[model samples]
Target: MNGMSRIVKKVTQLLVSIIFMYGVYIVTHGHLTPGGGFAGGAIIVGAFALIILAYGSDALKLHKEEAGSSASESLSILMVLILAVIGFFVGGMVFFNNYLPTGVVGELISAGTVPLYNIFIGMEVAAALLTIFIALVIFKEESK
Candidate 1:
């Protein structure tokens, strides 16, 4: 049983790592293309979920029981709010105004606020998923 579990863990971990990298790529290229924060972030968590399923709770540890995740979630929300407030002062009272420069078309710093917004959304999604995982893990443990 132990050997079987170890093998399964390794396979699932490899798959999760691959999908996580792919999600990062997609989020980075969000504004330039279609897939944005919500999609890419969800993909990342989906990969992580697969890993958690195959492995155990120990593999998902980040330090102090989901500390990084909670912090990251707050940071992302803060950033989004800050940007919106900046928009109020800079880009008039419009909906998600393109405050920053649009830059070139296919560049890293293009798409004005789109990329930034996508990044925050991605962070939030990733953190939220981690929180959910932690909650579920605790709930199951308590039930056991």
Candidate 2:
């Protein structure tokens, strides 16, 4: 899809970076902050959706991105599962146990497994949302 007016496209380009950065920040700081993987991932996906709106579906070539998103989602889910399994085996604990060291308070890496889980969840959520958006766009285009 062709892009919108030059002004809208330029504005979207500038805002997209800022939005993406905010999402990363939210995901990374989830353990210390109020927002976590889900919120941050949604924000990131929202930024992508904004781009799609500004520059139409065809311009983004979402088919390629859809595959990447699917892969990312699968990998993230696998990593989460692996982390849980490892935690169980190492400590003879239940799944999703926190086996790693808890660092200093108010620090970025303080929460041990929580932060890692948040990161993986963020990736999974972002990829899933992107895939959904791409599918919706494709369906819409096809129906038209």
Candidate 3:
């Protein structure tokens, strides 16, 4: 990478990290705070997008190639679906049900399905983002 690209890349990485951490903070405290699963998931991937823009196509080589990333992203989606189904079965009623007790507000373990959904969504978003980044980056490589 060029030197200016490297500096810009580092700054982007830093910003992305900060954004991801903020996402987590909002998600984890979603019950007491404003954000939740969807917000966190979207914001987390927002960070990934910055990474892609900053470092160019080669930045996410830490993960496998696009096909593997595709599989991983699919797996995370399937997992979320499976978990929701399992929750329904276990709850003996609604899908994505909060089977667990909704404890006091502001506690880590408070909102039941809220936290669970947040976690599943966060993971799914992260993996799917990686898949997307890998696909886009790999395309740039092939075009050369």
Candidate 4:
């Protein structure tokens, strides 16, 4: 697939960073805000989608032999599970327990494990969606 016109590429270049930044903001502030990991991840994926739309699948630069997105998704899932398991040993608690100190309310660092979990979840979701998007793009190209 070929990329769009120069104008589309320029517009996408201008907007992608802003969209990505908003996704990061949503992920980081999930504990105190309405939008959480899933929403933030979707937003990040949308940013990448915008790039793909403007520049085509080749813009991703993903090699055929490497499964980078899947690996990232797996690693993030493992990290989240490890964090949960650590809570069991450290606090003598069950799964999904919050062991870290909860600081002042309405603060960035107040939610302890919640923010950590959200970050991991965001990474996992973003990677998963990107992988799917790339796979679909590849399939579409191959079927032609």
Query: What C-alpha lDDT do the candidate models reach, one value each?
Result: 0.81, 0.91, 0.71, 0.90
- Which residue ranges in model 2 land beyond 4 Å of their true spot? none
**Residues 1-144, model 3: lDDT tens digits:** 532467786687568879989878876766777777667777877776676677654565534556665676677678778878888899678888677778887678887777766777776776677676666766777899
Q: Work out candidate 1's RMSD over C-alphas.
A: 2.4
Between candidates 1 and 4, the one scoring higher on TM-score is 4
> By lDDT, is 3 or 4 better?
4
Q: CA RMSD for every model?
A: 2.4, 1.3, 3.0, 1.6
**Of candidates 3 and 2, the better by lDDT:** 2
lDDT ranking from best candidate downward: 2, 4, 1, 3
C-alpha lDDT of candidate 3 relative to the true structure: 0.71
Q: Write the per-residue lDDT of candidate 4 for residues 114-137, one digit (tens) a residue.
A: 999999999999999998988887
Q: TM per model?
A: 0.84, 0.94, 0.73, 0.94
Candidate 1: segments with Cα more than 4 A from true spot: 1-4
- In the range 39-140, model 2's lDDT, one tens digit per residue, is 999999999899889998766777888899999999999999999999998876688888999999998778779999999999999999999989998898
Screening candidate 4 with a backbone cut-off below 3 angstroms (N, C-alpha, C), the clashing residue pairs are: none
Assess candidate 4 and give its TM-score to the true structure: 0.94
- Tens digit per residue, CA lDDT, model 1, 1-144: 322377787787567778999999889899878898999988888886776677666666634658878888999999998888888888678756788877888888887888888989998998898788878878877898
TM-score-sorted candidate list, best first: 2, 4, 1, 3
Q: Candidate 1: which pairs clash?
A: none
Error of 1 at 60 (Å): 2.7
Off by over 4 Å in 3: 1-7, 62-68
